[model samples]
Target: MKNILLILIFTSMAWGETPHDGMHHTHEEHVHEKFVDGKKLEVDPERFDKFIMDLKDTQIAIVNVQGMVCDFCARGIEKIFKKDINVKKIDVDLSKGKVLIAYNVAHEIIFEDIRDKILMNGQNAIDMQVIDL
Candidate 1:
């Protein structure tokens, strides 16, 4: 009887039905979407304003990213950029689906390099805006 019970449990698990399946499942109801130049983009204006204000006399890169749904995604992007000597600081906003990078005044803005770092974190860089402030 114990062997038979174990077999049934394993079968259920193999079929992708677990006891806690529904309990742990979560869905984010709020969809963050914006259209810029006929492309779907996600950004929070207030957050962007705040982020820009925090960096003084620095060049900022606002990268529109896809698949940044969790904190791990955010941290991964941050980690990759932090290794670059030109990057002064980095911030990832999952809600806005944007990665904000600050560079010193003399630092050059390289979109391909930024895209590569984001790609390393399993995300896509859809668009980028470089602001000289």
Candidate 2:
């Protein structure tokens, strides 16, 4: 009876349904679909250009960044700014280690968030300014 009970317990443990198995399988399928059909969406070049122009026109403030030592450093800073939904346009000069950030008025502008993001990415946020326009 003892041996039979042990066998049953071991069998149950071996055959137990794992909740994570199905989740991982579904996640892989979702990733595959994203990689396959994600590139099919077409973007109009004129519309895209206009979208950028519109963003530039709506910028309320600019943040001048510093401590960007090299191209890799500037690229890192650019990548962080790209994550911000409020940032419209980013102009970075690797040689000068400066960044000009243009923000959209339609979105809630938070210079602190931008500053924090750049600093967190191992750079400096030098100055903040209202757009001249």
Candidate 3:
């Protein structure tokens, strides 16, 4: 058993798969780590969309945001959107670098205001299109 363990260790080191190997750096050590370590979980796109659409009837707008690095950046945008009482949901598509904002009608919020809010979070909102209900 001991020999087997030693052999496995030697092989891992030889192949640069061990913790001390060249590419074994912890994610936290990365300079541009966009997500918190161990928090890079992914959700199914269908489920995420369904969750967002469940919001109360209001205005839904899809905004294309450029240069979103990761979920952390998306969460930052979400936080900003949440500050508005009219906001119902904020869905981010990091793959395409966009955010879908759903607002409650009670507040009569407009697209320009949503765009400004997104930009205020340090993301560039390239375009906004209302989702046809």
Candidate 4:
């Protein structure tokens, strides 16, 4: 068992799959970390839209934002949105200049508060629309 473990460790290191801060990093995670604009945890746009299309008793808001030029901006927006207890999923698409937020129906947050959350992140939220699903 010890020899197998040692061999696996060496193989992982040789393959650039070393543990990061004691956590195993997946290939996708490594790609995201190395590429500044790929930090968002989202499926492809088409798949995302379809996934949101059938959700019941949920609030989906798509916000057009300005000043989201980097990964930090995207992550900052995510952190701010997560403050709302009901926000279940967050997807930031810097390429589209949009932030997609989904919250539970039982605790829908006011639009003004959602806008405030975006604005508080030093981002200019141009507009937001609630998508019915």
Candidate with top TM-score is 1
Please report the TM-score between candidate 4 and the true structure.
0.58
Give per-model TM-scores. 0.63, 0.50, 0.56, 0.58
Candidate 2 global CA lDDT score: 0.51
Q: Model 2: what TM-score?
A: 0.50
- Give the Å error, residue 59, model 3: 2.0
Stretches of candidate 3 above 4 Å error?
1-49, 106-109
Model 2 residue 116 distance off true place after TM-score fit, in angstroms:
0.4
Clashes (N, CA, C under 3 Å) per candidate: 0, 0, 0, 0
- Cα lDDT listed for each candidate: 0.68, 0.51, 0.58, 0.61
Candidate with more favorable, higher lDDT: 1 or 4:
1
Q: How far is candidate 1 from the true structure (C-alpha RMSD, Å)?
A: 11.4
By TM-score, is 3 or 4 better?
4
TM-score-better candidate, 1 vs 4:
1
lDDT, candidate 2, 1-133, per-residue tens: 9999999998886542211110000111222123133321122334324434645445434345556677765677778778877776776655444455666656655556667777776665654544322
For the record, the alpha-carbon RMSD of candidate 3 to the native fold, in angstroms, is 17.1
Q: Model 1 clash pairs? A: none
**Most lDDT-accurate candidate:** 1
Better of 2 and 4 by TM-score: 4
Which residue runs does candidate 4 get wrong by more than 4 Å? 1-47, 50-55
Ten consecutive residues with minimal summed lDDT in candidate 1?
Answer: 17-26
User: lDDT of candidate 3?
Assistant: 0.58
Residue-level lDDT tens digits of model 3 in 1-133: 9999999998886532111111111122222222234433233346445755566555556566666777876687888888877777777888766676676655554556665676676666655545323
